[model samples]
Target chain A: MEQTLRRRQPGETVFGYALLLLGLFVMAEGYRIDGLYSPSSAGVFPALAGLVMTVSALAIIRRIHRMRPAHIPEGSGTAREFVRRTTPADVAVMAALMLAYMLALEPVGFLGASFAFLFLSIFYLHRGGLLTALLVSTGSLAAIWVVFRVLFTVVLPSGWLFR
Target chain B: MSDSLSYFLMAWTDPQLLLLTAAGTFAGIYIGAIPGLSVTMAASILISFTFSWDVNPALALIAGVFMGGVYGGSRSAILLNIPGAPAAIATALDGFPLAKRGEAGVAIGLTTVCSFLGGFVGIAALAIAAPAISEFALLFAPRDYLLLAVMGLLLVGSLSGESLAKGLYAGALGVALGMVGMDPMTAEGRFTFGTVQLLGGIPYVAAMIGFFGVSEALAQLHNLKAPRIKQDVSRILPSWSLLRRYLPLSLRSSAIGVVIGALPGTGGDIAALMAYDQAKRTVKNPSRPFGEGAYEGVVAPESANNAAVGGAYIPMLTLGIPGDAVTAVIIGALFIHGLKPGPMLMIETPHLFWFTVGNLTLANIFMLVFGLSGIRFFAKVVETPPGILIPLILILSVVGTYAIQNSVVDVYWMLGFGLFGYFLRIYGFQVGPVVLGMILGPLMDTSYRRAMISAGDDPVAFAQEFVTSPLSLVLALAVALLVISQTPLWRGIRARLAGG
Candidate 1:
């Protein structure tokens, strides 16, 4: 079988450049840790690692530059295509829910935050209506609470508001 | 000999130990088969709970989990395209294709048998080769360790993903992430950025859950509407002829698993990947083309990964060096139980060594029984709609992260890494190297520093050591060849050589 080349993703160039910037920033931080006065210094490995990352990012950028431009879907611009491909509605919404759940964990507690996150995500994604989402989320939450809290005895965050 | 024999049979004779082993194996399978749950997470959590227990029972339970978890990864790899663990990444190359072809039953059956045989090979090797290999392992100097870590990163980087460059970047990024804490030797902060939370460094378990678990859940969103594949369950057990046909290959792969697993800073993921690569090269006739539902493809990785469990114990039990992340946790448990685990422990507590060998053997047997019996039920997991499954996976990821330290900060880190990993995946980058790099980075950093210090901080001396020391030279050469093999020049040469 013949090897097939990878098709370019729409925003791959931007992502590659972002990585390059991150690599350079890491190199700067590595240098700031400790100068090259001693080989045994902790900064040396981090610096080396950063250097490798920078070089690899450059190489990747070059490869991405050489690839054929990604094909935009019909009647859509490149930005739209990139958005649709990388972060579609479902992913964006789910990610938002996750962020919200994480933020709410301390204030709302594990039980409240988890229930809301699970119920809302299931309802939106599954589109099976409210009762199905409610039942599934409640059941899963109960199981998780029993296993992790009651059995494992993990000290989950209790809401300050509740207290 | 009789004493050793009786100690070896300890778990088998004790009722509580027997039950624990069986339960641990059963739980390990589900834990490993679940998308967000991992053997490392389970082992670490179990450590916290079981630290107060007697060493024998705790060891038995952990051993069972380790054995079963390694094999369990292949189940998800075959049934769904998502690998349950990094080791199963290679299994999914062909296993998922087989599942798509309605041969999920046959694939699972073949994988189960091969894994059992492989587990036996690893256990037998552990029993026979532990002392000898530990002696060999002791010769690995800091520089040699640095070389081994480099070789591992390079190996994983090249094995997957769209290009070598992307893989290298990911690996380096991981190393950088691992650097985000106080320097071990100097106690000076490296990348703490004046933050108290950053002083402890990023929780790698959180990184692991994010990259492997949350990222996968997000990726599955693309296929939420896609219907699940209908599996044929008529043939759950492989024919005797089929087992006989693959026996030699399974044994060969198991040997590969054992060696890689025995090597410190390496584990089943690398072993399975290498075995898959070896099978791709050696097998003249496969059930089908590799990456297109080949039976040999599934068999090779399944055998190698399970064998790695046994291989992983050798260094942990005999040398005090963990064979893998799970073994590292097991080592901590050993310490908690007031036992040291280095070479002296093998001599001082010979019965412990014997008991472990016996316990691992029992776990292997339990793995096979538990692995095969639950297939019909487990296979149904893949049929679960992505809509519901994705949310549950995310919750598990969050809980797994929180359970590590009860810190909300880790949950945030996990989500951040998950988003970043999702972006990487979309752009055709492999996240495996990143995880491996994170795991190996601190080890590599310390080794590099120690080697440099030993070389008196002279670059020329450090360079010279690579070629002068026999072990260093071999590993250095291996790293050189691996790097060269990934270049375009090497690929061109290979194609020309093949054509000629």
Candidate 2:
């Protein structure tokens, strides 16, 4: 049987450059303000940080440019396989879940929103039968609720539904 | 001595306190046994529950949890390849290999005993060294703290994944993240970007949960289809001869743990890894090399991390500065209960110091009892589907984050970090340096700026002062040597010198 070869993709290099560009932009924004105690003064550290990041990114880019791409394992044939090795789909799912969480947190109340978020996230990750997901999510939510609400006496968002 | 004995007796007589200690121990083991949950998180959560309680009970509960959580992480690291916390990363190297060979029970049992021994030694050191160390710590000016922070940042070279430069970048990024909240000196907003939530700055706990907890869950999803783990749970205890053999190594590791723990900003995770590395170097005879089911590997790390709990308290009780994030939260508890920690704390509140010592001793004993009893049940949790566990962790992370201030903003920040952290991990970036950077950044920044001001903006004066101080000079030389050892030219020269 013939083995398929794998190589580092250009897209990965592009992604690195994109991060560097974003960091540079942020650094530029940070430098725009000048005041000792002004509201705008917070930008100084971020600006300095962004500059550092940009330099590091450039170094990484140079290093990557000089390096030979890695060979794919035998029996795996195709660019798709190589991409799978590098980029995990879960990253996208996790990103989406976080976005949903941020958007829904205020509207849904801490308890209701967190419970739903937990359920969906578990389902996505576990891909288990509904019963298992429900049992786990419900148990986790109840434990959290008891700790925060009953024990700590901290007020969580009630949302319009609870109110 | 008599006053300390009475405090110890009072702690022993109080059954409720004993029970809390026991519960905290059991809970900490389970928390540590689970991959992704950390002792620090467990302690942080316990703080909220104990917030309104009296200082003694609150300290007892947090102390119990702290001891338990540190030992608990080794459980998962041994039984499964997954490390329950960063402290257990070194443990997992040898621990998982032993489990794969069907000696999971023995590995765990030995870890439990070593953890107990380590905790005791750490407390013993703390009880003896804290007064003297606190006195020394009192002499530390802002300039000294700045130097300490720089020394810590140097660890980036060791911790960075594959590339040292990358690690420095990650660490610098973390320090910047730490800079996001309110500026300490000016009380001015530096990075809030005009948002009310930004005024308070980023919460460390949220970033921690996202970085360690949420990021691990995301990574686990990639390998969800791996085969379920199976093991016999009957042979949990190590033979007497096995215990006798590793006793010296455990003691040495515990000493390392205490020393590392005493250093401000350093914690158990670093201590454990360094101890493990040192053990590999020092111990000549082994049934096998480390990371291949070596008993010394497990014993060294388990002992060191547990001992770190005692080491951490030395600074907390002596100086006002917290040794780690969990201790920082405990500092908040202390302040709320009308107690302040610092040099004068010993003079003003001797009983408080004794109470802490008593509490730590009790927490360690409870950890021993609880750690040995529940091997079978926790092993079963490994079989629980990731779908269930991951979501459950997320829920806890959210509730835990929100409970900090009951603010939805923290939850948002946590989720954002969680997403960012997941991507960072996928691209071979390490998350540990970032957390270390965030925690230590402000300390570095404030102290450096303050040191400059104190020196009248004269760089030469600052240099002269550091050189004149015996301790600072030693520390400066150590930093210089550490930097030199990392350079390619230094390596070549050292190799040549050795050859000659």
Give the candidate number with the greatest lDDT.
1
Extract clashing residue pairs from model 1.
Answer: none
lDDT of 2 by residue, A37-154 (tens): 3322445556766787788778767666665565556776546654565446765676677678757777788767877787787778877777767877788778777755775565
Pairs that collide in candidate 2 are A6-A72, A42-B190, A126-B387, B181-B201
Residue B226 error for model 1, in Å? 1.6
DockQ metric for all predictions = 0.70, 0.37
Candidate 1 stretches greater than 4 Å from native: A1-7, A73-75, B80-83, B100-102, B284-289
lDDT digits (tens) for residues B1-500 of candidate 1: 99999999999999999999998998888778866667887888788788888999898888888888888888888886667788898898899899988899899989988999999999899999988876777788999889988877887788667888998999999999988888889888878988887888988878978987888789989988887887886788899999999999999999999988998877898889888878987899998988799999999999999999889889998889999889999999999999998888979999998898888889888887887787888777677777788898899889878987889989999999999999999898888888878888998999999999999999899999999999999889988988888888888898999999
* lDDT of prediction 1: 0.87
Tens digit of per-residue lDDT, candidate 2, span B1-500: 89878776556679887777777777777766654356665666677677788777778777887888888878767765556666776787788788777777888899999999999998998888887755665677776776766666655434335455566667777877888766777676666777777777688767877776677667777777876657667877878899999999999999989877776776787778767866876899976887688999899989998888888888988888787666787888888889898777878988888878888898898888888887887676566676676666666666667766677777777777776777677666777667767777787777766766677766688678789888778878867876676666776886789899
Task: Please give, as one word, the docking class of candidate 2.
Answer: acceptable
Question: Could you tell me how far off, in angstroms, the CA of residue B269 lies in candidate 2 after the best superposition?
Answer: 4.9
What lDDT is reached at residue B392 by model 1? Answer: 87
Angstrom error at residue B29, model 1 = 1.5
Candidate with maximal DockQ: 1
